[model samples]
Target: MTRAPNEDAIWVALVDDYDVVVKGVATMLDPYRDRVLVAELDTDRPVKDDVDIALYDSFAQPESDQEQIKVLLANPRARKVVVYTWNFHPELVEAARALGTHGYLSKALPARDLVAALEAVHAGEIVFSDPPSRMRTPTSQDWPGRQEGLTDREAEILALITQGKNNADICEVTYLAPNTVKSYVRNLYRKIEVDSRTQAVVWGVRHGFLPDHHRIDHWRGGP
Candidate 1:
């Protein structure tokens, strides 16, 4: 995927099931077309030859997303496969990298940074966004559900549950095992006076516990 000294453009392919996003990203990158060439592959068939990199946007994927990476890897033209996603959990980044993903970039990155990441990947660099450290001790401010006496971990789990993630999904993001997640869910439910996921979600909504702005920045036309 190396370009000659005179060659400045790096060919890229946007892979996603949503046509609107593909088109939207294409438009966003139009300003940098000379530097990052959006390949003319068929929209119906995202994987194709002559692509230097494949940017897979995991918008609403399940917990088991390795198969998605494998599918992109199977494409001979996708010399480098990158996962651009809103899910920037440390655990998810490590999992994607373990599967040989060249880059695990956050969707919140600006267009220029995204292009830089692709170029870095093409140059044989393993790129990943710096995920928040789970080891950091949480202060009262860290717990959005502090008034309810929910621990930092419990608050995080509740936020994910509000976003419709199951135990497996929560495990992937939090790096917690299934049993640990279940235990946390049980504890949080009791703390919040909820017995089921449905009640938890309702509580989260009523208390204004939505996914953080950083995670949803892409939708609001931010970097």
Candidate 2:
């Protein structure tokens, strides 16, 4: 049966290729079970159960302008789709809006604020978090290289590199300046103790940098 928002908690599905990323968000929202119930955590599979929102996490995945947004929006099970991302470039935001996304939220938002935003979106309001002044590492979230002293941004860059994205590709996808992308690459290389791209890719392969290529079925429990 299709579920609708009522007096109960808003049902949300966390979408991302990395289990750690979506699980982090789920854990952040766990305390707010009365206001938000994370009904699904979709790694690569389509969300099965009907949900009020599909929170698309942009960790190691394509930005908002890509086809994934359309895929999420097309799923009838997801009543709304929201881009949960750190990149809030104007073009990216506009593109998502043009594509009919219900919201574009920043990763910097605290768990409480995130829940509030989700509630607002569920109430039929098109919401967008103010462009963050700076991309501070969200302490509550998790990424691939967090254990090795790599910040979320650094870990994202390394994941892209592992996926065979060059510096130019990185800049295009991340909306970062050429020099900035180079700097991130260098920093991640240093943190991972690799001196070259090939070495970094090898290390990334060994240490969970590659994305989980398949969707997780029966996540938490079978739908």
RMSD of each: 10.3, 3.8
Global fold similarity of model 1 (TM-score): 0.56
lDDT of each: 0.67, 0.82
lDDT (tens digit, per residue) of candidate 1 on 100-130 = 9999876566678777888899899999876
The prediction achieving the highest TM-score against the true structure is 2
User: lDDT (0-100) at residue 173 of candidate 1?
Assistant: 55
lDDT of 2: 0.82
- TM-scores, all models, native as reference: 0.56, 0.89
**lDDT by residue for model 2 over 90-129, one digit each (tens)?**
8888999999999999999988999999999999999999
Q: Candidate 1 deviates by what RMSD?
A: 10.3
TM-score of 2: 0.89
lDDT measured at residue 152 in model 1 versus the true structure, 0 to 100 = 51
